[model samples]
Target: MAKRRLGGGLICGLLLAGSVLAAPPTAVIIGTPPQPDWTQLTPAQKSALAPLSKDWDSMESVRKKKWLGIAERYPKMKADEQNRMQERMREWARLTPEQRAKVRDSYKDFNQLPAEQKQTVKEKWKAYLSLPAAERQRLREAGKSVQLLTPPQPEPQVDESLAPAIVGESPASPGAVPQ
Candidate 1:
């Protein structure tokens, strides 16, 4: 019995020593790059991502990496492409987190469509854009009414710049409502 107790104590002591000598748990995630704070970005990265400066530090590591990749490519893009990217970034930065999540979900859904279905969707979008502004507004209002049975939520404040980019009609234009 004494020998058994000594053996048990020795095993316990080894385990305790092993645990004590082990490295402390790290806050760092494996397989993902370190998310750099905004101040850590280089001048060119800052310039390329100026629109997102306010939200950069709050962004997820994956998102930061994606944007950093875009910034790296920004200098090589054509002038027109660069301008469009900047405009889109500004619009994206203006979106609330829920809106951004919705956009991401929609994008994923769209990408999962078969090639033919994707083409059909693109065509349908074009057709919708071709409709008269008043008709579009009427359609939008009708769609809203269809959702009346659902619980009401506060409306997201629409940015005027986002209006034209989404519906091909400037907010200043007659019958142009930001959806």
Candidate 2:
């Protein structure tokens, strides 16, 4: 009985030790690095990210890092390129969540397209965006109108004479005796 008790105790100790070793590590609480103050941001960084200023502090740390990276690169970009980035950022901010999802899905689909088709889509989209706002709206309306006005295919016709012949009877002509 004593030997059995020792064996059971040994088994229990081994199981406890195994569980201790297999347990996941506890999360360590460590001091996070301080976020940069808005004033501490470089003038160029502030300017390039102006639209985000109001919500900057509320942004996640990871997002702040990403914006900081962009800000760092912004000064090196050409004027036109910087303008394009700013415009894109503004547009992104203005999008609803559903709209953003659509953009993301479309981007993923575009990335999966063949290179030539992707280029064609890119060119067409650029051309579409380059038009004045009113012209773009008018073009969209025209496209809808065209879709609505499209003529449908005519119904298939069966010649009455051939129809009777197919059924093993002659179609009687006007003022003629039926055979």
Candidate 3:
């Protein structure tokens, strides 16, 4: 009778242990606000972030929150500021992930420069914007070519064993005479 009770208790414990081991982990996110779906956004947010509507659901929560904050502040901005912001949003929406990452890195680098250096960069950008359309196009083309000139990658190794046998070739011997 005592052996029976011990065996039953051991079986119950094994079952409980197996269940605990098989269960998926439950994540508990604290403090961070939930990212809303596109349909969950307010009308003003939808209007302000129209360019990102197609991609809204797929964006990271932090990026969604950042854009939401921008949308919230959109109404208070001046007309020129609103227009600039809209244009930038559209441009941002069009950028590839790699391009966006590069732009973010560049922005971070720019922000870290000293005030005077930042001012110099702004002045240089303004000067570049002031140039003739044709001159700017030429400069852009030159920059693109420079960017395209990356170091060549090494050729991939071929597995001769797995390769298709060439006509008139034998597996046992090289340059074997055909029978």
The models' CA-based lDDT, in order, is 0.84, 0.76, 0.83
Q: Which ten residues in a row have the lowest lDDT in candidate 1?
A: 145-154
Candidate 1 lDDT over 67-143, as tens digits, reads 99999999999999999999999999999999999889878977877777677667667777787999778877889
Scored by lDDT, the top model is 1
Expressed as tens digits, the lDDT of each residue in 99-172 for candidate 3 is 99998987897787777767766776777778798977887878842232222344777778744354556777
Give the clash count for each candidate. Answer: 0, 0, 0
* Top candidate, metric TM-score: 3
Model 2 TM-score? Answer: 0.52
- lDDT score of model 1? 0.84
User: Candidates sorted by lDDT, descending order?
Assistant: 1, 3, 2
User: Once superposed on the true structure, which residue ranges of model 3 sit more than 4 Å away at CA?
Assistant: 1-31, 144-179
* Candidate 2 per-residue C-alpha lDDT over 25-138 given as tens digits, one digit per residue, 9 for 90 to 100: 889986546668678788888999987787678666767788888999989999999999999888877877688688878778778777776666666677677879997788
Global lDDT of model 3: 0.83
TM-score of each: 0.59, 0.52, 0.61
The candidate with the higher lDDT, 2 or 3, is 3
The C-alpha RMSD in Å for every predicted model, in order, reads 17.7, 10.6, 12.4
